[model samples]
Target: MKTRNPLPIVRLAVAIAAAIGSCLPLARCAAEPAVRPPNVLVFLVDDLGYMDIGANNPDCFYETPHIDAFADSAMRFTDGYAANPVCSPTRYSLMTGRYPSRVDATNFFSGKRAGKFRPAPLNDKMPLEEMTLAEMLKTKGYATCFAGKWHLGPDEEYYPQNQGFDVNYGGWTRGGPYTGKRYFSPFENPQLQPDSPPGDHLPDRLARDTAQFIDSHRDQPFLACLSFYSVHTPLMGRPDLVEKYEAKASRIVGEEFAREEQVLGDKPRRVRILQKHAVYAAMVEAMDEAVGKVLQQLDDSGVRDNTIVVFTSDNGGLSTSEGSPTSNLPLRGGKGWVYEGGIREPWIIRYPGITQAGAVESTPICSVDLLPTVAASVGYELQHDVDGVDIGPLLHGESLADRDLFWHYPHYSNQGGIPSGAIRHGDFKLIERYEDGRVHLYNLSDDIGEQNDLASEQPEKVDQLRDRLHAWYQRVDAKFLQAKPDGPEPWRP
Candidate 1:
């Protein structure tokens, strides 16, 4: 008789307790909160091309098995692009999430004297006015580290530490660590010691540093930027891979042809290029292996599921105009031009909850998008003005409204030819040559080669893009001719 028909009262008591629990202060809550935040690992390759990865083009000169494996677990961005045509500028854009031109750094520098147009001092690095991604992430209670190339600035005022990186293992100067004697060397080089080296290879050395960073901070949220200087000029590779490439080069560039050209006192056009490509391929392979090592470290650390990994290059592959002219074939021109080959680079993002594995995001995204994208991903609030919009929606399979992408490469490059600006609106692209102020228009949807110049036929379209480009240039206060107007021509558009 004591417990008879008491079910209704028991239910009422349970409801009252639930209501009280919901009303209690969060601090007094019964369940302990999960304080974990995702880790971010960015593997930035130097001067990589559009078709470098197996996923982009399997028949590419450099076969990247490890990269393909990583791509298997990532989302491949087909239309990814660099913020600038060259290295230093794109790097600056990647770190700050702003266009390089806006900062008066439109070209690559190695702590050298600046040219007339770009009068900014190279001795000083990226302006302290700009906030770095690392600085912002550190505010969110994440441990930040930068391994490898840090070209934004060289002086103490511009060092990685000053930029908010807690620890920076191997990055100084404008270029990279020089291995052997060469035609040219960077101003400051931090040589790696052999016996206590991170790995036998330079790429592996950088990878090892990244692994250490991850291992030390796996329990907590971390931001590790691993920049590998592989496959750049002065192509160097492991002795074994070098030998393999040497054998391959010997067949491709036939000894008889090489000797015959020498006998005639003429250079064999194909011999040097063939040798370079072989070495270049090996360098790329080494870089891919470095990426593999980092991926493995993430997996072994039990934080792979919660880590968001991004892989990309600073700019397009170095063209024939530079030291080592890696090919960016079928896309026209490399490195310094306004062509697709110069700006387009490989991009892959792997995050379990945010991006789908094996997904392809062909939505156009520039290097400038990185800052806003990462900020959103890391749950950070950005106060500074950012030119790029958050591309997290695109990564999540959401549709973005059609928008035009513009570029302004003002300074004349040492190798890849003259100054230029370009605008990509939908499938149509308008290229403006600064040398002659000539406008070339092409529908990239139909012509990825950019072989045709349809400016005459598409006059109205050309004028529209040209005006829009310059209007933006004015809006950003882009670097331009100050001393003398470069002779006005008819506005064709």
Candidate 2:
């Protein structure tokens, strides 16, 4: 009649279940069902050169304490490169993980300049059919926000919002901050309404907007693309910073800071041998300050530990032209040239648990690599073919197998660069000019400045690299410059 004491039996069964659960894998009985996805913060600086930051350039004049400190705490890629030597194309590559040539967006949006040969067909807008990084992440329930420059398309239909960003701020067609009276607000952007106080700097306002977006979306995974419209054209900076740089410029020691000139074609391009443009230095400092503000916000929101931060530029500095602002010296030509200076960039990535702090990877990485690396980080499977390989292994202190890097810019650059296609298979790089098909080879390890041409002595190496470059062009279905029907004019700078 005791009925086997059912209550005692039930208590014993519960105790046994607890013990088994404790012995099982933590993931099986974790209090938190799933770990939250890390947030992504991309700091895309316009026209920032490879040697612009103190970590890359030992004697850089501009004060980039924030960026330098960031590099010191992140993984620095010494041979990082942009997908193109121009803005829109590199930006497109960043978003799509494909070469700009594949989408026919090889130049800045609405860029119609003609040269000796007619430029290849241009795609003014990024096609909606192609998946964007934001779009891919959005599928995984991430909030995507874009702040600052968006030159992907000419119309509103192809803007950040239409391209999977839930929030778009200051994104428009123009490449530079040419609207809203340039840089300072009353910005002419339709997506971004002017709400800040008058005379507020654009970079600072964009940073604040990004911080606000992060604050609002703190509980969820988010992608905040902070593309700064700084160190671009209409180089304007805060007055106090400008004054400080001017004072610094005045106290310079010798003719050690003299400007040099080189003839690229018929025109003499003034090369900035030194990094002491007062206004430009100020602009760089302001941009760095803006970056500092965003980083500080991440710290304040307590998400710094779980956020992946990437800092890079669309292309090299605007040294050869466009006010000749900053310098990319000891590397060769500036933005638009298919040289070390034009494509090489200051790339830094920070992933709290994955990447070792202060590590340096000399293995060259391109802007297209960003999407795949980020996708891998978030456990997203990429369905489309991407030109860039996931560099996640490199982040973890492993070396990637040597691969050929390619660049094809068939149109003449406004910055005094000729049309050319280049490829680097190893320590050597071969550049083939579209005008004459003449190839120039350089041993980048020995001649980082690209001063010596070793094509004659290294003919076989040139042939090998050229063949690989042409093969890549065919693989990517790259378009080439066509001879004008009226016959090509004499090549000019």
Candidate 3:
């Protein structure tokens, strides 16, 4: 037994040798701190209209001083778009870098309302096989975290922590902060603190959780996806902010409601043309404060320069439904339509040292492009095929090929938007309505409001764009409207 104890002595000698080796000026231990890897932060707001922020529309009703200042320091996209007109489909695209239509995940999860026809066989959950942004970042030795709004799946298996995140705070099955007083204290969200005071707000709390994650993971690379549930529905705001906006809104004078051209449904819906919703305005400002707090944390952690920040929305604002809270005035159609207002989002990217301050890019970008862009930015090579191209070139003050952008949403939007597919090629865009196969064409450069229809005038362009859109449907295996029990068969692509 005493002779066999030599193994312990050998272990002690090895430990001493390793400790001395670490202190030695070896390349792995001593080369300028080895330059900690870059970090990624994706800030997503829910149902936020493009013009709702002061950066896009300064004369607008709501105030977003923090967002405006951030826009001044970041690169703004004039032609950014989501993958669909609704939230879930667009969210799926951002996670997988693939068109939501590929899996028939076109409608918002579990949404199957039959308008003129039954919605296509719905795929309600994001497939677990898909490599999410968090999973990919993890391969690069980065800690991943997701906070707020995980509406991708119907159960826990599809939640962020299961998908790839090491930390998940306030992300669960429900889309909105629908716990306790809804957005106030005692959230009752199992993933978040449940015993908060009545006055505590959801957005601010989510931001604090995210800031703490950054501080804890500051020693290593990390990806913090702070997706907010603010300004979505069941509108509520800080009482002080509500009062502030109420006073500010009183000074403005204009009609609040305007008749939107009847796009679908039996009756015409009134869209809020004025941005004077006091509660919504307050929510916007509070969300801005949350954004500002996270940005400040980046500086406090001494990781600001090493981070790539992105800001966008899941879909367009709630101008046509759920109270018609805000207006998408110049942009036709809100949350559910296949028009500019439903899909054109306010996208911004800030790459500290690499990007110019207050720079603007006119190139068209989609939600799917996010995965590949972040991959390239972090020097990670993607092994899976994706529908989105890397817009990293555009971010570097270079150019991207004039490629086409596409969207597919086959469900009746709770808002006034119809089931349709749209394609944007150069300045010409075409919308294909599913009920009767009728197409509406507009030159977006000439008609940002999408008022003038050129389908009859530009038949050849229509044919060209329509052909391209059909080809995409085939490529993505897109699904469309289904016939009802006694109803006419819906049009097929």
Candidate 4:
């Protein structure tokens, strides 16, 4: 019950967790009173890249064969994460399981540039007294919808149907698909209408309007969410997938850019460690053919065994900057550099008959742990304290007690990221650098390409993760970077 004011008791805990309709372990629904709860869906791909999928880079050059056959029926997550590295603070910590730096919302919604200081005061939006995980699954009966890029508010009262979404395609307040011919179609997104045709393809017209909103809400519990302003940036594709990735980027070959050590301005930023981008691999195979056209409309509405789904990405992959397109090789710094290739993502999840299919699980989890792990696999509780957990027992293989994952941006990252903050804990991570507090640590099970810094060989694990990342920046009241009135005063804890 420790919410910073949980929207005045969040519709009375969403009418008593929907009048106590319990049992939902992904809709197996225990005793099955004629079963019903699952149908969630989720997708969410912009800027994609935890090695752009082939089940996390089987030499990924960007053809995610239907997200690697839905990551072989989903569990996958070799350390997923994205509670911010870009895109509207990891879509406001995946619609508020909390931690978009509590509320400064860290960065990317009306981004406010500034470097040596000046970015901490940028609220931008996502507030409407905050209850959203599609307004607590619309009082638990679900039927939500929402299609693409909702850059978490700045107008229209806070789009995505005022933050609960009963239906809102192309969620607005700008963040790309910047209208008409932007990704194709006459998509002049005023909540994305013009319903395709006129050169269709805005990720197959938002995956055929989210597979006709999961075949008109398959028979009840829908959530939908689709969110894919394709591989991001105006990097248009689909001229036959840019001529099949320009003949597979003309038979690939080595050395694509290098010089990275400059964390934001003073120049030195190259870093596209080579994923031959032909219009971002034709916008990552037309957003994996719109996620295999919404997983073939959840197997033609047989509800794909009740439907839980949940893929990832909201940040990472725009290798170094706008035209850098895609390459997060060995994962260092990409999208905006809170690095592990800017918040390593592409996690899967599935949940059909309780998860385990291709079950992978390295256990890092984030994106504010997808609203308390799909609102506790659908029974939907979330009464308060959310920094993220309940990985639904790591999708059934089980085990989840250790914790510690943090990030804050404090601005300056139109890519070429600089103001930073990070922490990882278990395999050690650290980071810091908000102008010059200067720290780096690594270890990520032996440097997951953070290029081995270990902050001067682990000075007591960088003062125990910089004192638990400055006590989680005073427990999420974390805004930072400020001087510049005539400048000369960064680094504040």
lDDT of 4 by residue, 1-493 (tens): 7748778699899777666646443544355576577878888988888887788889888787988888888788889889888888788888888888888877887878765568888787889888878888878788898888888887888888987888888788888887677887777778776567688788888888889988988888988888888888888888887888889889998888887866545878887888888888888888888889889888988889988888899878888888887788788888888888988888888888888788888978888888887788777777888888877877888789998999888788887687889889888888888888889888879669988686787688799889999998998788788898887888787
lDDT of 4 at 297: 82
TM-score of each: 0.85, 0.94, 0.93, 0.33
lDDT by residue for model 3 over 357-376, one digit each (tens)?
Answer: 89999889999999999988
- Pairs in clash, predicted candidate 1: 125-153, 463-493
Overall local distance difference test of candidate 4: 0.83
Give the better candidate number (1 or 4) by TM-score: 1
RMSD of each: 5.9, 2.8, 6.9, 21.5
What is the C-alpha local distance difference test score of each model? 0.74, 0.87, 0.89, 0.83
Q: After superposing candidate 3, which stretches have Cα over 4 Å from the reference?
A: 1-33, 263-265
Sort by lDDT, best first: what order? 3, 2, 4, 1
Counting clashing residue pairs in each candidate, in order, gives 2, 0, 0, 1
What digit string (tens of lDDT, one per residue) describes model 2 on residues 1-493? 5657689889999999798877885536555568889999999999999988888987999889999899988999999999999999999999999999887888888776776678777889999988999999998999999999999998888989999999999898889888666877677667778556678888999999999999889889999999998888888878898899999989875433233332234546666666778899999989999999999999999899999999999999977887777778888888988888899998999999988889999998999999999999999999889988899999999988789888888777888777788998788889888776778899989999887999999878877887888888888888877768889643321
When summed lDDT is taken over every stretch of 10 residues in candidate 2, the lowest stretch is 255-264
lDDT of 2 at 269: 63
Which candidate gets the maximum TM-score versus the true structure? 2
User: Which residue ranges in model 2 land beyond 4 Å of their true spot?
Assistant: 1-11, 18-27, 253-265, 488-493
